[model samples]
Target: MADGSSGDSAPYLRVAARLRSRIADGIWTPGGRLPSRGELGAEFGVGENVVRRAQELLISTGLLEGRAGSGTYVRAPFERRPLLRTPSAAGLPYSGLAPFGFTGTWEADSTAKAEAPPLIAARLGVKAGDPCVRTSYEFLSARQPVMLTTSWEPMAVTGGSVVVLPEGGPLAGHGVVARMAHLGITVARVVESPRPVHVDRDQAHLLGIATGSQATLIERTHYDTGGRPVETADILIPADRWDITYDIALPGT
Candidate 1:
């Protein structure tokens, strides 16, 4: 976007664009430390504030990563790995999208029996304080934490059922569709909404990234054919190591 016109873009944006170009140009190889902000400012003829903003933007976009007590460096990019979510033609999608940072296999920890908060209750159409089985899943890819997912299932539907503990039951690795099927609930549909999110201090520690590192949040819900909501979950993905791709098949194609 740098058209070489100073008036066409904001000072920080121009700096960011130039740095992006430099990164793409391989001026600083992957994993190489970038020049310090003061040095970059002098080289680019910009002030420290402008340089800082530029660096922050790049850091957020995964082009750069900052180290504690160390300088910023180019972030290495991995292969475009797939977090597979294959859907069935008639039934709901059986695949659960794994964290983007995963290169091969992953694992998660699940807990239960917590009151559903207002937002979650609203999503599941339950009372604000309704009893639900809550499970927090931290997924690791390539032996590193890449995503966090917290799910809630109302006791009204899953209570007294054998599949109560999502990961412990026989259908543990089968995902939401099969789990619901075990309770005579057929997941006819699934929905997901994704949005941008920046990592927090604790999240950064878990994902081994900076606090302000970029990520995406996906709010997903499963539904039965009768239009009843069965389960709801939130999936967090690191932007630096993950990419999302959607696949849809047209009818009769």
Candidate 2:
């Protein structure tokens, strides 16, 4: 047994690398349970804490999954589906937001009169501390949580209107474009900026992934024909689960 202290790299990282190699080499098949921390510590000549950290690193990388009351195991490979994004159109149904072929249900809650944070307010073209309707959603497929989203709409845009509450009134469950159109605001385009991010504790718990797991954060906003922002949202998708694809129409096509 070799002590993990021989190299300059962190002890846990070295152990994690070796374990990753072992898994890649087929020493541990997919869904195969790994030996206990004590056993791995003994074999690696390291402390149990080091082994635990190594396992955690692998878990965050989606290479392993830990089951409560059960040992950690190699994660089984999964198909990565593509989430399609296209230009915004008037009257697009809320169901159209689902990934292709994703026959699942989503739950959403809207909080009216919520104050918009600085970042969100900027995205919505509103001043900080402005009242906004905040809606959070959890999209599930096959009963497994797949996506999380939090959207904000400036109250100034929808205040006192029937569509003020995104998930309420007759426009309930209608998408942003349609909801805005109901208010006589013509939605012209949708813009999205996608960036890689690490899932936070709350997000990880909701997505059923380890904290610090890789994910994508998409900042999406709907703009009216006059170029005024109507709504802005943060869309979170697990990196290991889906790929985002944009559908851009060519000019004059």
Assess every candidate by TM-score.
0.66, 0.72
Query: Whose TM-score is greatest here?
Result: 2
Give lDDT for model 1. Answer: 0.75
Report the lDDT tens digits of candidate 2 across residue range 48-165. 9999889888888789876544678898876788877755323344324566656689888889999999999888888899999999998877555788999899999999999998
Off by more than 4 A, model 1: 1-77, 88-92, 97-103
State how far residue 91 of model 1 sits from its true place (Å): 12
Instruction: Tell how far residue 187 is off in model 1, in angstroms.
Output: 0.7
Cα displacement (angstroms), candidate 2, residue 187, comes to 0.6
Supply candidate 1's per-residue lDDT for 193.
88
What is the lDDT of every predicted structure here? 0.75, 0.82
Instruction: Please estimate how well model 2 matches the true structure, expressed as its whole-model Cα lDDT.
Output: 0.82
